[model samples]
Target: MKDSENAVDIKLIFQFFMCCLVAIVFLSSTYLEFSDYAQFQHKLKNKNWVQKTMEITPQMEIEIFHYRNHQSKIIFKENQQEIFSKSCNGQLELICKYIENHEIQIISLNFYTFLDKNTNNYNEFLLNTIAFKDKQGQLQTFPYMTDAPNSPQYIAEIKTEFRSFFIFAFLKHLIFAIMFLGFNLSFNVFKKSTIKLINNLIITTFSLSFISFVIRYFLL
Candidate 1:
């Protein structure tokens, strides 16, 4: 068999190294993001919060994406009613009746759904008259969160819009690709460059991406 190394050039070797780097960087970063993502998902597996706002339908699966000031994204999946009430049980039939004929504001339903692609609607609905189970197992409605004792421990709940979790995931892959290409090119620059470089921008970019990718993947 003929030795293939004879056909290899300076650029090829450099790029091979770069590819290795990219593999490392992307792999580690993806791992971290996936780790955090899994934790958020764990909550939805089985848990319960309180009923604060509108009644969500048991049939509907509510996909919840939540974040606070500079926090990683958390995605919650559960029944719509539970997600809305923050109880996140499988069903919240008892909560909806109370919200129908009540006057209130600043509730616990931090549930958000987009009206359209461009708009996010957060129904901050609270009611005075809520329904609960009566002595005879019938629906008993009464007000909630009004005198629930606003304390420092009770963090305020708010809702906001978010992009698909995959968007961040896609972005992460793109970053890895750039690193792969750049690291491959950087090692070849100012020498028998493995990466073709007739310009400076291409050279600089390739170098950084290359170094970063390599270090993150191989060394880091």
Candidate 2:
């Protein structure tokens, strides 16, 4: 019986080591992907023109497309206090009227495909946030930009949700399903004296993972 127990303990230790290796790979890959995404976002927000508009005839519906169908649409607001365009609609009205919240049909994105083309784009990154006023005159950009070490929200229209394409925000929350077990096992290994340390590790991991997902889903 003693030999059998010893064998089981050895197997468990091996499994734990394997898990650590896997976790290291996962976290490292996540960081690298995040770095690439940050660069793409920065290019988008640092273009020459922050915003522009195509003059639409009054009361016409405008179908806006950018970077190959990063899309949204709105009807032109007739007789409204228009800017730039012959008639205003879409993000323009929503922004000018001070519909300052994210109640409008706008997606604050953090990640984008930076094709080596399109130097004519009228957008740019001011302090990590992509600042562009869309056709509807709405202030466009991702809500939260962390490309810089200590970036803050530059505009007021978007709520600064800090979405990225990592999917950790949406999918990784379910990881708590199994993470707590890992937590418990780690705690038992230290004979309960390092319980706090284990818990902190878990919390930090989950928080980082959550932020990663937010950036992945919204930005990338």
lDDT of each: 0.40, 0.45
Model 1 stretches astray by more than 4 angstroms = 1-8, 48-164, 174-220
TM-score, one value per model: 0.26, 0.38
TM-score of candidate 2 relative to the true fold: 0.38
lDDT of 2: 0.45
How many pairs of residues collide in model 1?
A: 16
Query: Cα deviation of 199 in candidate 1 (Å)?
Result: 26
Tens-digit per-residue lDDT, 111-165, candidate 1: 2121222344433232334344444556544443442212222222210111243
Candidate 1 structure, TM-score to reference: 0.26
Q: Candidate 2, residues 59-138: lDDT per residue as tens digits?
A: 53333322344433332343553221211244344442332343443333233222234574433323222244555777
